[model samples]
Target: MRQFFSKCPVCGNCTTVTSYKCKSCGTEIRGEFEPNEFNNLSKEDLEFLRTYLRNRGNLTKVAERFKISYPTAHSYFNRVLAKLGYLQSESFHYAEILEKLEKDQIDFSTALSLIKEEKEVKP
Candidate 1:
């Protein structure tokens, strides 16, 4: 697929969509149109989101699809959620973290750090 740029090529900053055209009729519309939110993500982020959606937002399914650990999959999911403005950096899925802690998959200190780290990420 051809990559559509969401950022200004020269300045490396986000670009505004100023116009649109009809492909078949040659009708044109010009204005400050908002770009698609998905366009803001990179190729990798898009693929991750595709897989995540394909799995119905199941973190375990996403991990299996990616052939990765749950924590790793969770990290990717969280990153995308943050980028899309769907998640606050200071917030987390606490139940999952607590479950890991109860199972001894993560120690108390690591669990605390994980929770703390989320708050440290600027919103």
Candidate 2:
């Protein structure tokens, strides 16, 4: 099955579903319907999100699965986060923390604590 985009490809404008169909009755209805958050993600982004969730949000594992580097995975993850409005660009340095955590210089708890501290210090 093919997927329809939730945003216009040309102008980057948001899209709305305007039709509905009933499988049992073969009836169709049309109206403006808001797309859900999942519908807003592209197929590639959705695949990345699925892999991310499957690996328990571990970017290292996600990178390994995709045969990409950790930084690449971090970039994709950050893009998805921004698309979902959960994060903004330059909001936090995930790649730095991931590198630190991977080198065993700091654990997850310490990394999270440091992130929290950084957020506190930011205006």
Candidate 3:
């Protein structure tokens, strides 16, 4: 048996998955099946998410624990969310607004207004 590295040949992306084959029966399956979200994450991302969760979603604490800057920790959290498919480029800004609203830093009306303003600015 040989081990295959899960990476893209052209782009060098690391999110590849292995296919299974039955040599005896000549049965084969190409491409990756639907796996859990965590499986799609790299080892580094998984470690970051674990530490972030351990810090109770506190980016400041996570940064202190990891000895990284707050912005770096926050970026890692966003990257993990993106890898898990919980975030999309178009929705990230809105989601951040929602998070601010949840934290009571921004009122609901302000969030709605911001969303409207964004929609108006969209080309």
Best by lDDT: 2
> Candidate 3, residues 1-123: lDDT per residue as tens digits?
753445555787665455778879989889856456786677788788888888788899998988876755665687689878888665666766766776688898999999998788877
lDDT of 2 by residue, 1-123 (tens): 557778787999998889988989999999999988788788899999999999999999999999988876886787788888888544537656766777688999998997887777777
Ten consecutive residues with minimal summed lDDT in candidate 2? 88-97
Q: Each prediction's TM-score against the native?
A: 0.71, 0.62, 0.49
- Report, for every candidate in turn, its global Cα lDDT versus the true structure: 0.79, 0.82, 0.75
Off by over 4 Å in 2: 9-12, 92-122
Q: Give the Cα-based TM-score of candidate 1 against the true structure.
A: 0.71
State the lDDT of candidate 1 residue by residue for 16-92, as single tens digits. Answer: 77877888999999988766878888899999999888888898998898888787778677777877888864544
- The 10-residue segment of model 1 with minimum total lDDT is 88-97
| Candidate 1 ranges beyond 4 A from true positions | 92-123
